[model samples]
Structure formats: structure tokens, C-alpha cells
Target: MAQSNKYQTGDQVKVRVDSPSHHYRTPTYIQGKTGVVVAICGRYRNPESLGHGGDGMPEQLLYRVSFAQNSVWDRYRGPSGDKILVDIYEHWLDPVGV
Candidate 1:
């Protein structure tokens, strides 16, 4: 089955973990944190692991997730004015409906 390409930057999304045991690009602290989308980097079949052979679809949408610095770090010395950005795959996101 083909997935629909319907996501946009600035969209609110929730990152869900499909695998608990495997290491992921998403930090564990931000797994359940809600963030806003910053950018879209197209689609790819593989995750960004230098060791993992790149093999998958060419249509995976990549997105930049932005979270507040205070939300991610416990002892962040930076002012609340700062934020963090993480590049994640689209599969990690879902519509954040409260």
C-alpha cells in the first residue's frame, strides 16, 4: 500500500515509538513531548544510521521537529528563549489532537 503525502511544515505532531528496544534518532526524553514541525526534507526508505545499510522507499517524508529547550533539558543553562531541533522521519509523527 502507498502512503499519502499530506504533511506540512509548522504542523503539530506527536512522535510515537514503534520499537522500544532499538536505538533511534529521537531522544528518549522527547519521545512523548509535543513539538512543532519546522521543515520537510522529502522521503527516504532508511533511517539516518551510518552503519545501517540504506535501503527502503524513496518517498519517505523527513521533518524537522522543534521543541523548547526547557522541555528537552533539565539543566539547560540557555534561556527559555532557545529551542531544540531534531530531524526525524515522518513515521514518527501523528496528528497532535488534544
Candidate 2:
């Protein structure tokens, strides 16, 4: 099925910080962290739903987001050029405030 994406490449976005009672895939490390949308991986079933044996319908848009090491870790001791990439679903992302 075709779905519209709320973000595109180069768009700056932030991962949501939520503690849901159900199963979810977004890692704790990236929660509340900001990143850039590197690529759109198209829409797919929500993993949290699939993990629980649900229909996993109403697919969600997945995005390949890249973040600076320092952005993910405040005390990152690596090179300033370091980066970390993670695939995050649209539901877990939101626009960063100006």
C-alpha cells in the first residue's frame, strides 16, 4: 500500500521518548535524541504489533536516521566526525522545534 511520509531526506527530526506498556522497537539510547533523515525505507508493519502476533496492519513509514555520536552520547569521546545510523518509524519521530 502507498503511504505518505511526514519527513524526507535532510530533514531534521527527533526521536520520541515514551515508555509504552506494550512491546516496541525504538531503542532507549536514542530516545529524545535528534537526528537527520538519511533515507526513507518505505512503509512496513509496526514491529511492536508483529511481535505480539497481531495483524500488524496499517503499516508505518520507516526512515534511516543518522545522528552525531555526541548527539546520541553527550560525553562521546570519539572523533567529532563520528555518526550513528538507525532505522526509526514515523510514529517515533517528530519535528525538532526551532
Candidate 3:
């Protein structure tokens, strides 16, 4: 497992989609969106199945990510509402470039 930079609560970050295995908290809609790292949720064992449930799996680290409603949807007619928070794994993030 790769060591993750210890992210403090409310640290802003950008998350990228690597691959959608079987189960992950990263929603398909936000795969390539830039968001803030809201909280560190600790490490979790990867639960992706290799079509047979026993191969090509790696341990994963989890984090809570938050994104503005306006940042996610262009035509979101609904009130911008509160930002959405997602529990994302480490493999799903990359540092955002300014």
C-alpha cells in the first residue's frame, strides 16, 4: 500500500478516477471533478473482485471528500444546496494543479 500524506480535516484536494471496480464511495459523476478533502476516514481493505473475487486487489485508504453543488452540475436547477460529501478511497485522488 502506498503511504498517503496525512491530510488534516478540511484540507482541499482534487480527486481523479482511476478505475471503477466493484464497490467504491466515489460516484461516477464526480470521477474527474476537483474537490476538497474534508476528512481522513482511515484505511480499508480493497474489496474489488477480479471477476472471481480473488485476484488483483490492493489495500485502499479512505477519505471524505466534499464538492460544491455548483461545481458538480452545470444545470442544477435545484438550490445549490449544501455541498456534497463523499467517502473516497486513496487511489481515487491526485493533487490538484493551480
Candidate 4:
């Protein structure tokens, strides 16, 4: 069965600001940051579960999220238009307005 995506391209989202004691793939720097969904990267087995010797089941939806350099860093010296793309799981994101 195919999983339905919760977000679409251009949708505004914010990375969940969580610190789990277990293994996770979401970067610490991107946590709590707001970004726009750029693309749906499809589903994959959850790595956090796999890291603990458990079967990675119920694949998670992944998306390409874009964040402006200026917004991600306080002293970013790059162009204001510069942006970074991060592959994030759906569990690590929340809809901006919801």
C-alpha cells in the first residue's frame, strides 16, 4: 500500500524541535527551523528503529525542505537568496499553520 503524503510542494513547514534519546537522522541545526517543502522524496524504512536492532517498518514519508541561508544562520555571509535543501522525514515536520 502507498502512504499518502501530508505535505506538498510549496507548503510551509517547521522542523520539530525535539531531542530524542534514541537514534535519529534529522540534523540538530535544522531543528525548530521553518522551511518550504520543495519535493516529496518518497517513503523509506525508519532508521531510528533500525538503529535499535528493530525491524524498520511502516516506512516514513520523506521530503526535500528548503531553508534560506539567512534564516538558518545568524551571520550568514552568502547571498540573501541562497538556500539549503535538507531531506527530512514527515515525523520531524509540522505544518506551519496547523
Candidate 3 lDDT over residue span 1-98, tens digit each? 46755565666677776665465556678888878887888766664544456653566678888988788888767677658788887777777653
Q: List the global CA lDDT of all models.
A: 0.73, 0.91, 0.72, 0.93
Q: lDDT: which candidate is best?
A: 4
Order by TM-score, highest first: 4, 2, 1, 3
Give the alpha carbon lDDT tens digit for every residue of 1-98 in model 2: 45568998999999999989899989999999999999999888888899899988788899999999987887899998999999999999999865
- At residue 70, candidate 2 shows an lDDT of 84
lDDT-sorted candidate list, best first: 4, 2, 1, 3
| Reference-based TM-score of each model | 0.73, 0.92, 0.71, 0.96
Give the per-residue lDDT of model 4 (tens digit) for 1-98: 86578999999999999889999999999999999999998898899999999788878999999999899999999999999999999999999987
- Tens-place lDDT per residue, model 1, 1-98, is 66665567778888785664544566667787778998877666655442255455454578888988897778989889899888877767888874
Q: Of 1 and 4, which scores higher on lDDT?
A: 4
TM-score of 3: 0.71
Error of 4 at 27 (Å): 0.9
Output the TM-score of candidate 2. 0.92
